[model samples]
Target: MSFFTEIQTERLRLRKLKHTDWEAISYLRSDPDVNKFVKRASADTQEKALAFIEKIRQATETNSSLYWVITKQGQNQMIGSICLWNFSQDRKKAEVGYDLHPLTQGKGIMNEALKAIINFGFNTLNLNRIEAYTQNNNTASINLLKRNNFKLVIGKQDADNLENAVYELKQP
Candidate 1:
């Protein structure tokens, strides 16, 4: 798969991250609320954001993973990111992660993006299972996963840090 591919939905486009996206990504990552659940080497600097974009580029270049910048069709504004990570060598499983800008919350944009990526994971990538983990406090994420047909197989106490819930969706 190429590093950059445009995925068109009814109202959104999931495209590869670009160097020109730095300004928008920087703003989104800088938001404490937006960065609350994200994990990164450093969340405090532009360099960290650049490094992340580079890492995503490298991952796509190697065909090891896929990440997309969620944008609206006919507009260049970036509202979020959706990614498939931790791909198995046998191509049987992978994990999905996503985040939307605080301003864009409550708009159903993420739900649409999640559906598109899940289809890509199962149909395009031919994965058998896709999973996601979110902090217990992040109800929005958990609900999004649930709405997308991800079952809550594990509970709070089963989490590594007692602060997350793991959800999984198996291909049928």
Candidate 2:
């Protein structure tokens, strides 16, 4: 598909990321509370945020990845973002990633979004396996992976020599 395939869950909708989502995306990518474990370049500036949105859009158009802005059923505001990308050449596997607004933390919104994305990865995308990586201290993320039947896989250390846990869910 030239565009992202939208998905809907019980209480959330996974739609393609739009330029208007830059503000929310910037907040999630820049906030220390949310980016504590996500180690990427600074998206704290408007320029960086615009570039980030373009990156996702290009990835979707090229069928290299799928990124979705997660919103509540009746809400126009994005509470978070979820994606399945970093595809293996054969497209049998992909890596999943996500981030949520700090204000929405402790709610089940992400859990709901992830479930739908995982389903899309396995079913529509016909992927054989889906994987995720989270720092050891990210208990919430690790638990979410496990709840979705992803098993912990051994991994190597990062450039900083810090270890991150890898989780994988295989199609049954």
Candidate 3:
């Protein structure tokens, strides 16, 4: 829990961000299709992507968050990213965020990565809750959460992004 841990599944690997992953990060963060539902600063350039990676590195060092770059089982190129961040003061709760390259969408890749992340959060991190915020119109994300047993957080609002629909999966 103190260091960035790599997660592996049958066909995917989720590892810490690397300097060389800048290209994929840049595309993932800035692509219109990917960002259509996410509202965040763009890291469209390699320089910006590197800066973001550094920030994530610092967060992991401080135990503030864990970010992972998603790749195919035997591939070195990044096709997506996922992280657990925005932890509550008691550390029992944390927000989950993810993105997949458009080409990789609808392939159950994110779902596989998420299952592993959820296990890590509840078991390794011993967290009580994992939250996700998505644009209300993002049916794909909503469905993904549902498939993972995450429930809609009734009456909860995303102060940072009003357009986001809040969902949570309590530790079972």
Candidate 4:
């Protein structure tokens, strides 16, 4: 169950996750270097990865979440994932989370994906606010959010209690 077909960026295409993506998904969500800053337990095994995908797919079908596998334009290889989830009751707010393959890091791929999704949230979805939580030590993510004008909300905390800094981008 996919909501939108895909979201395209200059260098990447964000498509709905498929069962075939299990291998890449497992690696991205399980690899030590990749999940170092991620709080969830690793999806190291095929079963765990498949279960995770099912969860995301169900959420998407229910219109409660949207997750996309990130791939390069000319390359079908999945290099990462991004999602808008944890929606508020009124459906006007959501949290954004993303990851990129280590090899693709520092190349601004995630940055581009972020911009496109943020735009979709604001313009297409008509969301009033979009939020993100990143580990305080995850400087790259913090910097990327800042560059996109997502301001840190002092003293505000996520109910999830993951010990992350909360940032918000309000609709313009």
Candidate 5:
């Protein structure tokens, strides 16, 4: 199965990242609060944003990975992004990541989006395991993973200079 596929949930739609989404995506990625746990991107201009989007498009086209823009049903606004990165050739596992706009925090939007992505990973992609890592201080994310049935495997200091809590869920 193709890794890149649109997924629709009751309250959200996970669609491919498009060129037109750069403007909003740029803003989201540049937000300090939102980018705190994420690796910093050097996208300082529209051209860079477009280039980044194109790279994501190419990655999806090749089925190397998947990056999706999360939007609410009936609205074109991008509330966040859900991604499955570093896919293995064996196709048994992947690293999951997500981020939401600060304005939308505390609304359970991310929790809903994560559920949709995990369901897609296990049911659609037939992946056996999905894993996520969050900084130890990110209680919200840790709790979200726990609520989604991801067991905390352990905590370790990452090369990025943060104590990360690793969580994983295996398909039943």
Candidate 6:
């Protein structure tokens, strides 16, 4: 029932998350630099990280989400992660989420990964829209979204997280 698939771009690979990706996931979730503007629970310990991996695995098996680990082409170690989840009840919309190792930031790595995901969402999955919610103060993420042509959703807000501003990219 999973929609898991491997995606290859010019310089990167977006593939299924493996159990061995725990260390990278642990750091990506808990690192101060990476989570500075993030507002979710962190996997600060190994056990918590593993649990998260299992959660993601089960979610994928249920077709609840599509998650990918980002790495340079031919590499197995994950330097970042991205996902399309939180599908709207009608299945026309889904939220996009991502994070990268600080060392990998500013390299346009995420920009490429997101482009691929957007294509998958719109063309492959037949989605009508892809949404992103970032802290209004998270300039890097906001800029990334805008660069991908995601427009700020006027007057719409995340009720549970007032600090978040929603952005959306509709099918072309």
- In model 3, the Cα lDDT at residue 69 comes to 89
lDDT values, one for every candidate? 0.82, 0.86, 0.93, 0.91, 0.85, 0.93
> What's the alpha carbon RMSD for model 3?
1.0
TM-score: model 2 vs. ground truth: 0.94
Ranking by lDDT: 6, 3, 4, 2, 5, 1
lDDT of 4 by residue, 6-108 (tens): 9888889999899889999899988888887777867899999999999988999998998989999988889999999998999899999999989999999
Q: Which residue ranges in model 4 land beyond 4 Å of their true spot?
A: none
Per-residue lDDT of model 1, residues 1-172, tens digit only = 4634568999999998988787777777777788687554443567777877898899998878888999998888888998898888897898898888888999999999999988888888888999887877898998899898998865424334456677899998
**TM-score of candidate 3 relative to the true fold:** 0.97
lDDT of 2 by residue, 1-172 (tens): 5747778888888898888888888898888989888787778888899999999889999989889999988888988999998899999999999998888877898888988988888888899999888888999999899988999876534444265777899998
TM-score for candidate 5: 0.91
With a 3 Å backbone cut-off (N, CA, C), the pairs that clash in candidate 2 are: none
Model 1 residue pairs with clashes = none
Ranking by TM-score: 6, 3, 4, 2, 5, 1
Instruction: Give the per-residue lDDT digits (tens) of candidate 6, residues 20-132.
Output: 88889899999888999888889988898999999999999987889999999988889999999999988899999999998889999999999999999998888999999
Q: What is the lDDT of candidate 6?
A: 0.93
- Choose 2 or 3, whichever is better by TM-score: 3
| Candidate 1: regions farther than 4 A off | 1-4, 155-161
- Which scores better on lDDT, 5 or 6? 6
Decide which is better by lDDT, 3 or 5. 3
Question: Would you estimate the TM-scores of all the predictions?
Answer: 0.90, 0.94, 0.97, 0.95, 0.91, 0.98
Q: Native-vs-model 1 lDDT?
A: 0.82
Off by over 4 Å in 3: none
